[model samples]
Target: METVRTIDLLLDAFGRIPPLLADAVRGLDRAALLWRPEVDGRQGNSIGWLAWHLARQEDTQVAALVGGEEVWRAGGWHARSGVPYDEAAMGYGMTTDEVGRFDVTDGEVLIAYYDAVHARTVEVIARMSDADLARIVDRSWDPPVTAAVRLVSVVDDAAQHVGQAAYLRGLLGGPEAD
Candidate 1:
């Protein structure tokens, strides 16, 4: 069997995430896009939050292992989202109430955040040599993680949350792409 290259795997994962998220956003009025489900007793992450969280996760991963501060940390979005920042400006994953304080009402804010995340992902990944992937980096929680693993985690989580946003959009009777 042919061994798939690391870049190929990363791109494959990256390719699957955005369309789903875009689909979820397409045709959504501001209200429906931000609507939280009540019946499911869900914490109800709006599409905005999903986008914000995905970008924040990417920023953290890239910053933690790849070097540089997270974009959201520097931008004050985390605090705007009610998340407290570390001295270095990393988020500890704030509560829903804190997240509620975020100004998610603006579609442009979320879109811009995602755009930056995408650009940053490309910029960071382009600089990573194979040896760079093997270097160990300390994570904010639990155990130290490798650059490779963290990269995969960002891709996987982005896809998962995009699917979730898609599902939530569907539940709100929004039009999905054919």
Candidate 2:
């Protein structure tokens, strides 16, 4: 596919996430949002934590791609989220305990944070040229990562998490949860 078309597809995919997530958690109270299923005596991730993780990942990864400050800091999301974490915390490699500590009870704010990050992602991708997409962004892998690869990775991660959130909401027995 042409590079611009590819980016446009990515933008459309990314644009769908926030509303899907919003629908998934609609009518959920703070307690419901924080509910976790148990497997093997350990609590699974809650809807709140998953949503926060997705937002943080997108904010950090997109910021890196664009060579700009993260929306978490630049757009005041850290304070807006009222989550009591440092600006750079993106939920990667966190311990179970650390994951359990994510306590953003207000679903509206969480969705807003995701919206801001998604907007920045769309803005950045809209301006990218084919040459820009082909440039290597990370050299740590056996095959260096290109900007296109990184963006695709973000999309994949976001899709999985959002799907999981929707599934969990269904499991929680909310109306029209599916």
Error of 1 at 87 (Å): 12
Q: For each candidate in the order shown, give its overall lDDT on alpha carbons.
A: 0.66, 0.84
Over the stretch 43-66, how does candidate 2's per-residue lDDT look in tens digits? 888898888889889888988888
For candidate 2, the TM-score is 0.92
TM-score of each: 0.76, 0.92
Q: Write the per-residue lDDT of candidate 1 for residues 1-178, one digit (tens) a residue.
A: 9997786677667766655666667555567656776655646677766766776777777776666877775766545444333424322466766555444545555666666667778778777788888777756757677788888887888877777777777677623423
lDDT comparing candidate 2 with the true structure: 0.84
- For candidate 2, the per-residue lDDT at 54 reads 90
* Clash count (model 2, backbone only): 0
Off by over 4 Å in 2: 1-4, 176-178
lDDT of candidate 1? 0.66
Give the least accurate 10-residue stretch of model 2, judged by summed lDDT.
1-10
